[model samples]
Target chain A: MIYFDNAATSWPKPPGVTEAMVHFLEKVGANPGRSGHRPSVEAGRIVYDAREAVAELFHAPDPLRIVFGANATEALNLALRGLLRPGDHVVTSSMEHNSVMRPLRALEEQGVSLTVVPCSPQGFLSPPDLEGALRPETKLIVLNHASNVVGSLLPVREAGQIARRHGCLLLVDAAQTAGDYPIDVQTEYIDLLAFTGHKALGGPMGTGGLVIGERVPVDELEPLKRGGTGSRSEHEEQPDFLPDKCEAGTPNAVGLAGLAAGARWVLETGVEHIRAHEVRLTQQLIDGLREIPGVTVYGGLDATRQTAVVSFNVAGLEPSEVGLRLDEEYDIMCRVGLHCAPAAHRTIGTFPTGTVRFGLSYFNTPEEVETALEAVRAIARANK
Target chain B: MSYGVVLVPSTSHAIRAERVCHLAGLKVKLIPTPRQLSSNCGTALRFDWEERETVEQVLRANKVDYDEVHQLEW
Candidate 1:
């Protein structure tokens, strides 16, 4: 199967991922920090090693600041819901996942105002446009590192600088870019970063995190949950701290173990190489798809501006119908519909029907790309 | 091995549990509060031990207490 719907959740995770999870469940099954013993200590060791792996991958100075969650959506929820308050102003872009958009919209109930900067039709968000939307009351600027639908990467460093100039925090949803993209928290001045392990990271689902940078002051935001920390079992009140402030229960340790393994694999393999591989595959698909009559490819015209995702439409086929056909006849799997980012699709003028998105990954091969292209050609010809 | 369930009232309360797990060297997991178990927090921690009286002692010592310790099998 030519599995192209990786933006949703990557498939065929690294071989080591499941092994790591099983190892943890079988041998190191213990509640971290809930007790003091060999089992508990071993559990702590696993979690700590995971943190170190993440810290090393992202170049994050502190391992303690990396807070794990079920997925990027959950991490985004924690970052958005925990940090924003009534009367606060937030800025976002047209290219955000519903994971980021939905939570911010819910905050409207709290009187939090929002400004959504428009992106170029080719999927580029103009930092100047966002700067124009900035308010004196703007407390946070949320930017998706890459659009899940089109794979268009945003200019985060410039936008982060603007947020810093205004004393506002910059929150990045790195769902699509985390493992495939190299990011330095200090260099970009990003205050909060949310990443999922299921996508480019090649980890299993239910693994993601929110990185709280040193610059961001999150003290005022309320904890999403409160309970007995293994630390202060005697205290009924929940602890108010960074990871503790936002993290409220036992983490997804099995998923985290796999995610850590994935991150380590990315580090050892190098994101640059992964990125280069995807670019090569994407370009091949782009060239091949363009040759198919009645196929209209979408996203930035330049290959450098986008990642491995390629979105396009067949002239005569309904988006969903095309997806079904691809699966049934061509054995090609791709994502159809709004891709959970309606605004992005609307911005690209592909709302409702959305587009057929083929998201490539390092594991994909040149032969797979050629097969998908041939299948698209055959499908396009069927329309004739 | 030490065993306990660290219960929290809301989903957000797990952060403290995460901290305690990270700092105290415990294996922590976030599970929906088992309907059988009642607590102010809806999430509970399924700890990693068959027995550790000293683990409970440290929790009590550090003022980090739990709702109950059910010597449940893993």
Candidate 2:
């Protein structure tokens, strides 16, 4: 059986991910930073190691600047809600996942003004259009590194330069590109980077965070929830620090152990190597799908311009029907429907019907792509 | 031997300090912040008082965000 739903969460994680989680649960069953015992210290060290691994992967300046949370959604919420206040202006792109859209919509109701720059029909965001939407009160600009639906890459670095010139912060939702793409926070000028461990990072679920860059003001950012942070227990108020100010609960140490191992594997293997492999597979899939008579491919259709995800639709076949046939007959698993990014689908003109998405990963091979393409071709032919 | 403890703002900072000390060949351990040292009930990095100067230098070079330092009787 071929799995094509990696954009949701990667499966068959690299070696040591599960073992590290098991080791944490079995040998080091302790609440990290909540106690001063040896096991507790070891647990804290494990979580810190995860932070360091993620920091090193992204070239972040300090591990202390990383705040652990649930996933990219939670991190995005933290950055949006904590940083933006009433009367603040924010700008975003038309090609954004619900993670960014929902928060901004909610913030708009709370008196924060928002401007959404329209993207092209191919799901690419133009930096000039984004810069044109900026206002003097624009406090931050949130962008997704890549679209979860079509896998089209956004011009984050250009947006970063625009944000710099405008004296605003740039926040990138890297849920789709964190592990596969090379991102240097310093070079990219990303003020806030939200990443997920369960996706391309090859870690288990419930592990992800926001890496706060130096430009962001910690004093102004508020915590999503208030609780014990294993620091400043004497103070009734929260501790004003890099992570403690944002991290206020017992962290998922077990999940972090797996994340550390997964991130380390990505580092040792090199992101460039992974990208090269995925590019080959993505081009093969896109070329093969477009060759089918009734099948219509979506997005930029250029492997060099986007990620490994490919979206398509067959004439006279609904996306759900095509997905069902691929699973039952071809033993291929994929995701259909809006993919939680209605805005992106609408930008790409797939709106209501959405499209069948095949999200590839480093583990997917040329053979898998060929087989999936053949399956899609067969399904398209059957409809014809 | 009496030890000198380096107080940090958070557990993340304390763990970072301990890592820097170990890398510098200075043996250090994280202990509960001694009540006599500070009111902050967080982790503290304890080291031999004789290496107090070296500890200060290494932590400074690494830019570990330490709160303060105090010598504690063992």
Question: Can you give the TM-score per candidate against the true fold?
Answer: 0.84, 0.98
Name the weakest run of 10 consecutive residues (lDDT summed) in model 2 chain A: A375-384
Per-residue lDDT over A1-384 for candidate 1, one digit per residue giving the tens place of the 0 to 100 score: 888888888887876888999998999998765654556656665766677677777788766678887888888888899888889999999988899999999998779998888998778898889999998999999999988888898999998899889899999999988888788888988888888889888788888888889886767766667765554444677765555656667877777778878888888899898888888888888888888889998888456778888899999899898899889998889989888999999889998889998988888999999988888888888889
Top of the candidates by TM-score: 2
For model 2, how does the per-residue alpha-carbon lDDT over B8-39 read when each residue is reduced to its tens digit? 88778889888888999998998987877764
Candidate 2 docks with a DockQ of 0.71
Each prediction's DockQ against the real complex? 0.04, 0.71
Give me candidate 1's TM-score against the actual structure: 0.84
Position A203, candidate 2: lDDT: 90
Each candidate's iRMS in angstroms? 10.2, 1.4
True contacts kept of each: 0.00, 0.69
